[model samples]
Target chain A: MTQASSPPAVSIRNVAKSFGKGIYAFRVLDDVSLDIGRREFFTLLGPSGCGKTTLLRLIAGFETADSGAISIEGEDVTARPPFHRPVNTVFQSYALFPHLTVEQNVAFALEEQGMARDAIRKRVGEALEMMRMGSFAKRKPAELSGGQQQRVALARALAPRPRVLLLDEPLSALDLKLRKEMQIELKMLQEEAGITFLFVTHDQEEALTLSDRVAVMQSGRILQMGPPREIYETPTHRFVADFIGDINLLDGEALPGGGVRLEGGTVLSAPHNASGKVTVAIRPERARLAPAGEGALEATVVHSAYLGTAMLHKLDLPGGGTFLLRQSDPTEAAPEAGSRVGLALPAEALRVLDR
Target chain B: MSAALRRFFLLSPALAVILFLIGVPLCLMAWVSLLDKGGTSGVDWSSAPSSANYVRLAWEEDFDGTMILNTSYLVIFLRSVSLAAVTTVLSLAFGLPVALWMASLSRTGRDIMLLLITIPFWTNLLVRNYAWLIILREDGWVSRFVNMISPWPVQLLYNDAAVAIGLTYSLLPFTILPLYTVFEKFDWRLLEAAHDLGATRKRALLRVVLPIATPGIVAGALLVFIPCLGAFVTPALLGGGKTLMLGNIIQMQFGASRNWPFGATLAVVLLAIMLVVMTAMALWRNRRTA
Candidate 1:
């Protein structure tokens, strides 16, 4: 939530970055802009090489943008060095100082700020306790496990009470079970700290699970930016819909009469303004299955997978395209493999993406 | 064969070399250091073993057969120690920045610099000392240039300063190489962590880099200090024989004076000092780790 009278926590405008020069130059970020509200959990979601990390680095003052301005809490800090910025980063590798103990590492920034020694001790203890690393105060980072080290890194960054905290795939190193546990801890930590968190990750589930708002990036540009549900359910770009979740995309032609005609001569009455060749995306759970000759579309059931809570059926459409149906009702028996079945496509669920 | 016997057999060649090359000479030196001088053979093996030569280090017997305190050798020992310390400090000062710069270089650039650093090793140490002699001599251009701008005419050679300069120049690479190895493995991201934590560049260097590079610093100091303490050629040439170190005094006893027992005594004392320093360093390292 943002108040109109107050400035956003971080505002980035028209930032561009390029590496190298001459014929070998690579543009990593091009005209990227966004605003992170105060105390909001904002995530940059993208595959590798999409410049999400570069944008986070630029915001942290670790990098300089080729053009445009970055302001933190209404202060333009584009010309300042990282040391002058009121931001801290939880590095992907933790990057904990090996020679310093956990307590010393957590107190590093406070000491740099010239705080009183007693104050530093108090803050460091509190920060370590919050991360459940209070007992590891005198231990070196090398002696700690990877998850413990990550907690120490988070404590070190949060100890500074920075205006914004930047996390660069901080959980990508953990195992599946630990990662799930950490995701919940990270959300709770962000709420308790009350600082804007600008997280970067390629994991779609993590982005949706933890972020208040998600900005999906590709090729150095923000393809879509919205709440997780909005981005997931109403992705305006073809890349967003395909990247966000498992969806069935079908090639079709949009008629002037406001309906799409599939390649198999099947017409689905979905209201769209586009005409000529188009692509319609639908999530698997939005469609259902029926007995043969009972529904609008025809398909042959290829296989069925039990997903604990749901059954996923893979079917081959008449025009050679495959379709998916998520059957979550336990009472319904799934169609057998190689059996003819009727598939239902809802007009309200079909999303016509603008390429 | 048993594992222990097999291991002994595998290690026999190295053990035998150590015994012959190091152990035998040490035994011979220890025996010589306890005997008296012979009539002509330089060593009186039949003479009773005594601490006479060892006592000579602190008290030299006068013609009246009374022992008196001797400060001459003490002065020489002290000079050797302080000069070695100065050389080690100077080497660290010049080597650290060079090592840091080398570490920051690209792969090819680092290789080229490493090759350049090792280039001086190809030249003989004697030749290199002579080169320094030419550069520091009274009539040399470097001396002339210094004298021109100096408030008074300063003698650039035949002094402890000249000896220290020569020692540091010779042993600088000892410090740089070890320091470079530590710095080469340095995680530069730690510096970024320091900066992000609001540390200025100088603060980061002192607070983080220096502490992390402590092992290399101590190693470099030892490498320079040990050799500089027993340095003979640098003092002989640069000191011009007037400013004699322990090394020069020991050389005098063995060469012109031909006092074999006393020379052996001086060598033993030097080894004792080396052992003490090494032990102290090892103890300090252990304490830090603990």
Candidate 2:
């Protein structure tokens, strides 16, 4: 990651926006602020109506923020219209000009900038070639497949060489297999272009796979922002931990002796230096199944599911809470349904979430 | 029945209507246009078919019994075409912005505007033309207002300009409705995409919206132009017999001159020109698609 010494590629400060007016007004983005570093692939991850897409649109100048300011590459662009801004966007629908061929679509921005004909031709050719769409340059967008149209959209947005590229769920239209293929291509393209990419997606896995950092949003607020590993392993918010991946949370009380007391009167040794009520969160893969009455917590196995690469065991704790353990070792026998088992919760793997 | 046979059966009713309403009259007109003019019966049923009436469009027999070029009919034809073209251009100029504005309005606002546009159509065409005659007459308020601003008296009625105004006023809705439909279905995100790509509003409109709405614009133009070319009431009422068009000349041939062959020939020629224009447009559209 680049140091904070330089101005970030895009900085959003205290931006708030709402739709409608008066009592019926709905706040879509509330006091959102973030800085995306140069050449970094940053993603806003959230579910629908989480204001992630709204924030991206603000950066692209499609919608102006009701309050606060937005700057691109150290230049204030909050008051400027979309045409005056230096950034481009790959819209979710691709938004390729149906009348123009792929080459012309990629050349549109350069033409608007009054570039020379020869330069525009060269740039359009290079951009299309970079997207592996050189052969289809003469075809209109309707003639191409959805994935090919997506590549053309990317090419068009990148051809202008904007300081930042905002993508609003560009891969949501593609099927699962095509979405995966484009995800890798998108990452490589970001690196090759050497520009900051602000991507918005509701798919958490996509965000984790493509972004250098991910910001989790809910109710128009950024709950947490960090590297994917940090956001996944040490999410400060309970929503983030559950939204990112599958995790088991148990209600417990912190004891003065540096351990947690379960609701069912079971005490397990923990390493956190906190006292009072807390929620202990652990990923299913982080725990293991032990023989009955031999591990940190005793439980009865409810069922086991085969997940091709791993086996998932659901257990009912004595406190009536459920715990899941993921076992990857195929050689070990899985506890059958209704069998009693104990769960080993490693101290380091346990996260103490207060909210 | 098979799908193809079922489709044929389903289409036969429409085909029969077209053949009876459109096809039979066209055949009758063609046959009448090929005959010679009869004294009082309008056509000589026993005369051999000939191209004399068609020739009469461009040539006239002089007192010396020699054919000479006739510029009178040519002038009328040119006037008719030029007026229709002017009406089409004026309708587009006044209708495009209205359609764009309507498209940008809220759903309720758009529906209200659509109702306003069609309200004029509820009135009879002859009554509307008479209203324009009243509005554009010498002492009428519109004409008096124009005269008030001018250094000299400005005549607003009984000219090609007045005919054009009446024609455009009557046909404005034709241009607005189709263009409105196209704009309503337009993907406005394309404009946003253009703006995001650094195009100013005007440039985006010129480069994106207008090109996408080409089909609608052409349809509107045809809707106005085809009818304007053969318009009889507006020219006759507003022109005050000073300016003659193809429709007026054809009307005179059948009503006053009792020359049925020439009247039929004019109608056939008008249909032929419209057919050629429509065919060319279809061909051009197909080529663009290809």
Candidate 3:
């Protein structure tokens, strides 16, 4: 929280980009703007072709914006090439040179700067040690496993010690077990390095786990940008609520007395009374399974799934929709697969989204 | 049957074809290299097998008893090696970037480029060489262009330069195809990685792109060099009987001179040198990859 006042590490304003020329041109990034603070792990989260990777590339100076200013540490790098920018990228493929050893790969950026030989050797050694790949410094990329190659790529990018590091779906190639391990390692590493990380990924769990703040993008536009809890619980856009996780969206009307009136006149109290039509987004975990006729909405349990850590019960609402409730503590007298049940939708947990 | 025996049994037909086509002829050539020359009658194989043709290449048994170095044939062999090296280098110089460009093109564009390359092969090689002759002749288009620059129609038909240009042109597609295939599967993001690591474009081209493309370069070089070493029609038509390479001399031994044993000896020597160089290259490649 204190690091939020350390000034913006990267600021992009009204940036627009497109590919091709003339009639064939297709805009990839709309007028996107954001301010990422120093030492903050910021993520651009979206599905494929959401322009998240394109936005990350724009900040890295790989692509120039058609119009707008991009400032890194108060200096405009809009016209600079990637080599001239004080930034580095961990590419999606972990673009390690197959011909070069890990040590040479890590030392490449400093070597290009014409740094002192002794200093380069020391720094390369330190970077390799930091990634716990000191023993594999002499090995080529083809010889290392996928996870090791990812670590080596991380070491190479971080060895330059740029003010900000851009990671473009760097963990997408790893398997589930290794990806989980890398997610934890990457978050801890970013914290230790004290460098602002601009990560791009389509995985919501990864974004929520690693990012201090996330900007959910959809079709070249940012739908919402906030901390994970705010974005998940109080999503301003329906797209964000559905995309971040599974949600039960109920069409409702904003009542005048600080509540939402559903289609069947079931008024539920909420923090605010939005005018006109709205949608109530109830998170699966927040909506719980309760005894029959003792909860907010009466429903019948249609089915259930055992997810090892949590049991998901799919309930059919009385009016017309299905509400999914996730129960972590399975010790309660669980409702049978076809039993009558009710969903407890808390007033605070219910988010009123504008249509 | 064992796996090895079964594999050999399956490969016997191809091996038999190679043995009949290449190995049998090579053995016959080796035997012919050992025959002594006859006095206008024919090769006197009735006498005995002898190494005279091979020894005469180095130490000629002259009446004056002087063992002068056979620098003429040595020079011809060296010239062929140097010309082949130059042809390979030139082909690579032109082919690498062209192949890279072709690799960058769309699939249909690349297919069109490949079709254009194959179009050249539709014409007979002899006809193509003759076309070069007319194009390079005095008072021709090339000569007229030269006259505009130098006030004189410079001769470009009968020299090493003409042969070099012809060799590079003929073998360029050979070099380009292998390199095109290499760059086709290449991940271009490595260049971006190089740029992200502060390498300038030139540095990335040299350190990253060139190194990754070495195997393709070697494949292209071999394709250009091996054929250029024994290139017959190009030098024959372009040289105009002046700049005789080993190919023209070897042809002369078989057709005009009727010195079959000596020709066989020259073929064997050329084969030995190529084998040595190829073995050395294979060793170097293994070492590099390791």
Candidate 4:
């Protein structure tokens, strides 16, 4: 039974998937549920083997859930095959047909639908121009470099005008510089096309840069789901905090108020509701390094790495615990290794997360 | 010695063997083909050099036209190419799905399927043709069983149909093997990519699977067509000796007629045709690589 006239772009509920027989069975997805809004750029970010790709496949109708319902545009598409679904994916390998010219590869799906030659030509031309690949349309996939082929793959996927576009680490095959460029191009393309994009990637930076909202998955479950800044600044769980970006976690006990007491007998205030044995997450940039007796905790600078724009300091606390600090000013004098230093945990920058 | 000279020295043995064996015989064949035949004294070379033998072979003997016609140069060439094409299509139709299924199977299952595909290659080609001969005869088990089922039994032996069938059967493994290799190594994510892009199963197969498998299909087609051109055994046996194929005519000229010149001419023509086909294939392959 459906309650709304217009449904969400993608709706998945209690999906489970397993491979092999009884004794040899391996569960890859477990009770996974998600709802992607229409025309929203959604990302599933996680470590390898976290079932993010499987979840994307389930949404794309390439794989069926063992026990759940999937709906697209309000229709229950649980048994619908991938071809029937209004979805398209860009594979990580680029997957361009070697025998076809770049234009032919893009026009393939349209040709399969028996679209007229004129229309196919026009649409293919438009898509190629959109991807800035107009010049390479006549070339074979083998003739182009890695990044060019990736653009062709993107053009081919976008030419069909599917309701949803699924990208499975489409830029993972590129080198560092090309990958960065493609990330911006991909985000812009998704926005220009106005199609719901369900991108799957293990790269945290990619997820942060491209998604309107990201679902962080681990061990077949979504640990947290929110915008990049929200997920990075105010992670709701320990797993989310650690997976998204670099964070210095301080093991502490929850106080009566919205605060935590560190093992070093230092008290820090937080923004989340918490009680009894809790972990507070603070970004490396949040902590300021100074001479002992001037800051919150007595510590020693173990090592400092100059990273051009910033300097990263590894500090050892008095309680046999170590913390990392990232400072943007490389010109500031950082204490030498083995020198006693102070570690400052600013109340505004610290977040208490439930374990 | 320098690298180039040392390499030349290393290749001298093979070069010597080629010059002594292949090059010398080819040159002799060319000379013999040009010689004038004395009535009972065999070939005469002392006479003034002329295009007489080539001219006589083309106009007087009429063997050239008959041999060319009998070879069904047009039909056999087309038929052989089409046979390879059809076999490639059929093998992909059957083998690709089977290969995809096999690829999806467990390690043990894939090994078992691989063994099944390899089973045909292990047996001798002559034995396979003979086995087919037994199965396709007028009173053979297949015909007999069909007769029992239907009032009239189908006659499948000794015709072009039977030849095609035998050729297709013999070359099935060749087509399937290359296709299997292509399908086995195919990235399944591409199929997923097509589906995510709103392509149906049929479209995916046509667009993604077929185009990507072109290399294997072309390879399989060449494998089947080249051997099928010189197929003496299958056409001779399955075609019931009634068929005047080039192979049979060549055999008659060599064995019964003793016209070594005509037979050599036919052999040279067939080789020329093969060379043309092979050259075209090589060009196409090079273009693909480029």
Candidate 5:
């Protein structure tokens, strides 16, 4: 839906960063590299302490990388200070200036850049308008609600029109309804601004909803990078599959010529042609309950939850492991808990993670 | 006990101290100010009361309908206020950065620096003033150092400058302590936020850090300025009998001149100025917060 083949706005090349010193030194980002395209909405998704925020800070030049290079718009800026780099960040805490009005907060960067007073005022007005916070221009941050403050933070960061915007969990502080509203709003705003956004978030749903391409990371490394649908349906790593969504991970042995022999002698076609032991990953929404005599694995429905549109069932497989299933048809009756049923996991719906 | 009574009981000790120790002496001073002068020792309460002591502050009334404004006491008051203001400015300039640096330091480092700040307080202020007199007097090390630079020894001791130095040295802790407390609550993250907004370090300090620390700045100024206004010992010892601040004049009125009523009137004037300044500051602070 948006431009995807533009030149990269930022190029982080083999960048490595660590914290502490000597014996206590621990690498936070180990040989991490990525290209964020201009006008592309990119997200760094991972758990806490997974170096996602560290990578964002490194790009903003708030912290320098230990080795390798970071370039923005083909210009090397790894050694540059934060102010020298054409990048801005939306902090998790929404760090608006408590002493300043919303207009002054948004106009700060322009004022610092020595822009004309009239031009700074116009730009601040336009940014506030985009955030739908025009009337709140005179209000101090302490006088505003949390969501309103978050909008002010975004408006301030965007007022400078930096080459790239780095967001560090900017919506995590909002309540669920507001977070959902802002997720769609932020995605639309990124599209409208046409500037690259390198967002870091631990919430998988947030990354999936806002990002054009999501990079799933863990510890100090990027596990996989792809479009949201591709990342969710065909994850290249076990961590990615599990982190992205609820997935049933079954251990199986790969046979010669694109075949998998799961435990209990159940055979299924393989998506990958490699021959080795692999972790079979299946999403709950894809797995279906079939007649007992016709499915790949017989399972007992141990638990069922009616989730409005879909009925979720925790099925205990014949091989002693349990897998989750979601039946989307509301009209059909769900098999009672503790009743035996068959699960049909199509070959295309399963991914065997290798690395 | 009920919560209200319990709170009162908890506060009674401080209330008692303020009532008997501070309030009783103040009332006695007021009564003494209304009494007739008894030549050179104390006020004569049995003698008919008169307003001559208060009148002497600004005007000297002649029996022949001629009035002259005696400005010497007013000059001393102005001099004392100016010296205290100078000390306050100097202390804030020096103390603010130290407190900011201390705020940025590691906890143990800050504790050590605080200890360094506290250690000087353990020594007596009189002892410190006498030490400064030895160090800054003619033929002292400071004079010898100045003599090397110039042909003759500079008259640095017993001047306004020496008094200023003594006052700043004595009241630095008062200036620094409130600022340190203010800096403690300052969120260093605002600096990063400023940096992210394309603000240089200098810009950030002016726009962000300074505004956040204003409350502390105001508090430290009051703490330093009020005490410097009434400073007696440092100016007395370092003044070498040349400089006459309000404190010295007040001391002379009661100690040497034995004009108890006049001394009490001057004390009341100083007290009134302090109360007015404190009340104005508190009201301004409250309005801003509200």
Candidate 6:
């Protein structure tokens, strides 16, 4: 079934959060504004302690903003409590009731709504089947594996059919292989359920793979918001580019034209106009390595790391700055340690940011 | 020494202590329960092994039935259970909120409240029991103040009601401790998870908090019930012997009645009942866990 397109599921405007009073008070979230589209999977990607989870909690109505308005489906819900909000969260720890069986946990929200017994049974069975956990309905949470417990937690949240679903680092607890599998399953489930999803995670790969749009946050403020491709290819700030993916930042001064002068005194043209003291960022994949004396800057190979599919090389520039280059073929006759190398950076690949 | 010999040597002292302190008394009690009661003349150890004491309890001596049937005894037992249950319930009702409040407080505030809760345990149990008696007596200060305010004077001393009050007062802290232990460590995110799933405050408490707190409730109930069953000072002083309980009866048989065998038998029976109750509780707990 196609996902339904409606008005924005949640709209947060100028939200700020602070804890305690006076000297002890700490501001955790500052002037954060966001609009989560209906039936869209949106993710807040950031480093740890960046207030992304706080923003998710605010949208879920768990924490009230100190000053601002939160609206759901065009209705003002700034003062509403979590119970009154049409949102459900799959916590990082899952938070499954240890005392309850899988079935009882899945049926908790329905039971709270005072639904009919037969209806609850039917709905719980359907939810269990949806999560592929029908065989584990009688088992408690402690009996299930991490991935199974996570699926049970998801089923429990989804059974109530809330308009919006909040996921707070839902896959941070799983192994790499299991996390990848569950990520695909979670995306499929979100599509089938046709609900708005606000996923909070510090994993850039998870955000890039799952979210339709990603909001990169830093210290309680959204630094950049865009589609995954746009965010990765064209970051507005150095932090966003470095955080979203690995990049080598070179110290440079803005030239008279649309070019930058590297610290090594080599002039390179940039796609964007450089202003004041600037740093140019280029992805490792974008920089090409050649023999010394053939390219713009000559540098000696300091170290090389073999990463199965790709080989990463560390080069020492003449000006003492180091640059990292990635090559797919390690078996190729590459520069060995102490061997000098040339660095080729394309102008299109260089992004200039004003410091 | 060899490894096996050294291990045996290390275990010998504990085993010796267990044999002397526990095994010997248990064997003596088992031997006593099967002996014939020597009326007046003592030391009839050669009597045949029979169910005479148990049979006598059911048929010849109405003491067993009377002890079970006496309104005062039944009232005291029932009152003890109800009092302990009520106290435990009240403790949960009152203590849970206090614990939650304390849990939500700053570290210094939590420490202060915890210290306040623990202060009562420092006083002697007898002193605490007597303190209740002084406060609740007919001519006591509390009764005097109430009498002045009311048209009729309310007597709260030397009665089953007084025993109940004392029992409840004595066990209030016991109930609060376990409830506090569980509630203080309760993860608040679970409540938030429940609310995000659309449960109201009352619904979340009933569905989430209560089930998780069942172990604490059970522990607190046993802490109150088992002791209140054999409680002596509270009933003897506050009950004035008019509301004699099982413990007082056992005490009478051993102290004044001079029936050592009967007292031993009653003690064995009380121990058996307690064992049964504890065993049932353990089985229930195990089943729930399974």
Cα lDDT of model 1 by residue, B142-187, tens digit: 9999999999999999999999999999999999999999999999
Error of 3 at B152 (Å): 5.3
Say which candidate scores most in TM-score: 1
Q: Write the per-residue lDDT of candidate 4 for residues B232-258, one digit (tens) a residue.
A: 778788888854455665566567666
The numbered model that scores best in DockQ is 2
Q: For residues B1-290, could you state the per-residue lDDT of candidate 6 as single tens digits?
A: 89999998999999899999999997777677677656663324778876665654544436554423225434544554564455556555665676567777777987888888889889988898889878987778899998999898688888877887787777766777787778878888889888987788888888888788878777877787777777888889888877776678768766777665665676677677678777998999899777
Candidate 2 per-residue lDDT over residues A1-355, each given as its tens digit: 7557888889999999999999999999999999989999999999999999999988888898999999988999999999999899999999999999999899999999999999999999999999999999899999999999999999999999999999999999999999999999999999999989999999999999999999999999999999999999998877898899889988889888678887788887777777788778899999988889888988898988898889988889887878888998856799889989888989989887774
Residue-wise C-alpha lDDT for candidate 2, range B128-246, written one tens digit per residue: 99999999999899999999999998999999999999999999999999999999999999999999999999999999999899999989999999999899989999999998888
lDDT of 4 by residue, A125-213 (tens): 99999999999988999899999998898899888898888889988989999999888888888888988898999999999999899
Q: What are the clashing pairs of model 1?
A: none
Tell me the spans in candidate 1 whose CA falls farther than 4 Å from its real position. Answer: A263-266, A275-277, A293-296, B39-41
Superposed Cα deviation of residue B48, candidate 3 (Å): 3.3
| Stretches of candidate 2 exceeding 4 Å from the true structure | A253-277, B1-11
**Candidate 5, residue B208: lDDT:** 93
DockQ of each: 0.81, 0.88, 0.80, 0.51, 0.80, 0.70
Structure candidate 5, residue pairs in collision: none
Task: Compute each candidate's TM-score over C-alphas.
Answer: 0.96, 0.95, 0.94, 0.83, 0.92, 0.88
Model 3 agreement with the true structure over A1-355: per-residue lDDT tens digits: 3245555899999999999999999899899999998888999999999999999989887788999999998898999998999999999999998899999999999999899999999999999999999999899898999999999999999998999999999999999999999999999999899999999999999999999999999999999999998898889998999999899999889988788888868887776757999999988889877678877778888988888788888888778988888998776567887788766788889889898
Query: How far off is residue A216 in model 6, in Å?
Result: 0.6
DockQ of predicted model 2: 0.88
Residue range A1-355, candidate 6, lDDT tens digits = 1134654787889999987899998888889998888888999999998999988888788887899888887788889898888788899999998889999999998988889999999999999999999999999999999999999999999998988889999999999999999999989998999888989999999999998999999988999998899899989998998898888888889987688888879887886665778889988888998777776668899999999888999888888878888987877777789998888888888899877
Instruction: Please give the range of 10 consecutive residues that has the lowest summed lDDT in model 5 chain A.
Output: A1-10
Ranking by TM-score: 1, 2, 3, 5, 6, 4
lDDT (tens digit, per residue) of candidate 1 on A75-97: 99999999999999999989899
Worst 10 residues of 2 chain B by lDDT: B281-290
TM-score of 5: 0.92
Which stretches of model 4 miss by more than 4 angstroms?
A1-6, A255-276, A288-296, A305-311, A327-336, B1-8, B17-21, B26-125, B137-139, B156-160, B276-290
